[model samples]
Target: MRQKEIQLNSDELRSYIDSVGYEKDNLLEQLRKETQDLGDESIMQVGSSQGKLLEIICRIGNFNKCIELGVFTGYSSICIAKGINDEGRLFAIDISEKYTSIAKKYWEKSGLDHKITLILDEAINVLDTFIDDGLKGTFDFIFIDADKSNYIEYYKKSFDLIRSGGIIAIDNTIWKGKVFDNDDQTQSTKTIRDLNMLISNDPMVSQCIITMYDGMTLCLKK
Candidate 1:
């Protein structure tokens, strides 16, 4: 059965956001522009709307200790930090020091450097360290937006990292809407699709997919 697929185009959506007074500061705008300069890699960056949603989630939940699996240029990192408690800390893990160096510059410019810790290493390794250090169930929020093929593994590990009633936001769950296209069996698409299904069926968490900006799956640990 096919579902009715109605959604605004990019221009219309941007216009709607503008009309609604979606505010963007120079720092975020500049970071976005710089990330865009990376060409296709820029697609890894989350949309402005997604960033705002993340910040809103942090605010409403009063999330303080957060973990972000991927810190591409730090756009979402800043957004998450903005809504966190004054003394909140964010652990951002990424494999690329080069990209994180760019993120570091903006993070300091935004005065968020003190709140964010950049770990340049494989996300899985860092997660293992968290477990080894007995830091399980210590985070208020966990944002997963790294290698698509490892999404399920990341989710499984992140589940153990967040506290009860905490949130885990998974990016690219819809995979540009490719999850619905059975013909598309690419590894990335398949993993995202499988992860979405896994979350939907998991009894330990309550979940929903925000359709805005690719798709972000918000899961609340029980």
Candidate 2:
């Protein structure tokens, strides 16, 4: 039997679902709200629904060693950490120390600080270091959420670092629905479109882009 389809097209309905279906722990919830209160930068933080989904994915995959590009206040990091095994660790890379400071506070508050290592440097450079250190195909999960222009490159690096059965979740593929607008030839949009196409055609992995928050493309390494 087909399951009933429910739509949360309205803001009110979506908000209700966000509050009810994925009520984050108090510390995480506060960090999310506080980040949003910071204005446009708040969009950098993934939605509560997306955060919850990441956690669920981690738990289901038994994903322990992980990498997250773009720590943005650490909201997603905390979610990922929550679902990981107690001994699991996440290497979070971001360019801004200012923003990660906030994440640090919340991680400490959540008692998850020890589980995450925040790297203050260029994401690509960090990925290069991982490869230099001979750490390929070792990560159980990898999340790419930074520098839209380098998304394809990030995906490529992630592909090499992720284990055969591991998963790579790339956020912001839809580009606020700009991928469908041909006139919008912004580099970010163009790069995202290219990355989506590359992932679609690549035989090394099977993937699907889910319509959630901005859009998350979940890829399973084969």
Candidate 3:
């Protein structure tokens, strides 16, 4: 299978530099420093620019209902909340309450606690519950950055929960340039590759896979 790749070029670099310079998020900076204190593992997060792009998407999606499958320390969720928070609802799921609590503090400090909901459980299990609780087709946008083993399952579940035209953004699709190495059959890498193939041919989505920060696959349900 021939795979399409998104390469970040000089123009992209300049564009990002210009766009991200538009504001200084002091609180976000402070939170990053704090997360860094909890060992580098806990602080594993997307770049600041990606967080801000998520905010921009939230606004463009005009979405109050959003779902995030991974809440690693909450940096991305908080960054996302910054966008649709005024009249929106963001649900974050994770298995670690301890780390998510760390995320909570930042959300509280940033005055976004009221707008976001945190669920402390494995997202795969909680996903069905959210659906049974009437969340199916209720979300306008989604972000998935969770366990790589279940990436395909998560994508399928998200597709069911999202309405037509809703966008699903997935992180680490390229798995740090691992997808190209046929000999490197890491489970995580293969799973992502499979999902990419599936989504690429699926008639249901209009999509683009951007090779930014490991790689991000942005797909809109048709």
Compared with the true structure, what per-residue lDDT tens digits does model 1 show for residues 28-99? 989999999889999899888789888999999999999999999999999999989989999999999889
Positional deviation of 167 in candidate 2, in angstroms? 0.4
* Poorest 10 consecutive residues by lDDT, candidate 3: 5-14
- State model 1's lDDT: 0.91
Tens-place lDDT digits, model 3, residues 1-222: 998664553567747765754466888878777778888675367767778888988887787889899887788898788888488888899888877888999999889989899988888888888778887887888999988999999999999899998999999887877788888887888999899999999899999987666678899999
Candidate 2 displacement at residue 145 in angstroms = 0.5
CA RMSD for every model?
Answer: 2.4, 2.5, 4.3
Q: After superposition, how far is residue 186 of candidate 3 from its true place, in Å?
A: 1.2
Off by over 4 Å in 1: 1-5, 18-21
Off by over 4 Å in 3: 1-22
Better of 2 and 3 by lDDT: 2
Report the lDDT tens digits of candidate 2 across residue range 102-121.
99999999998889999999
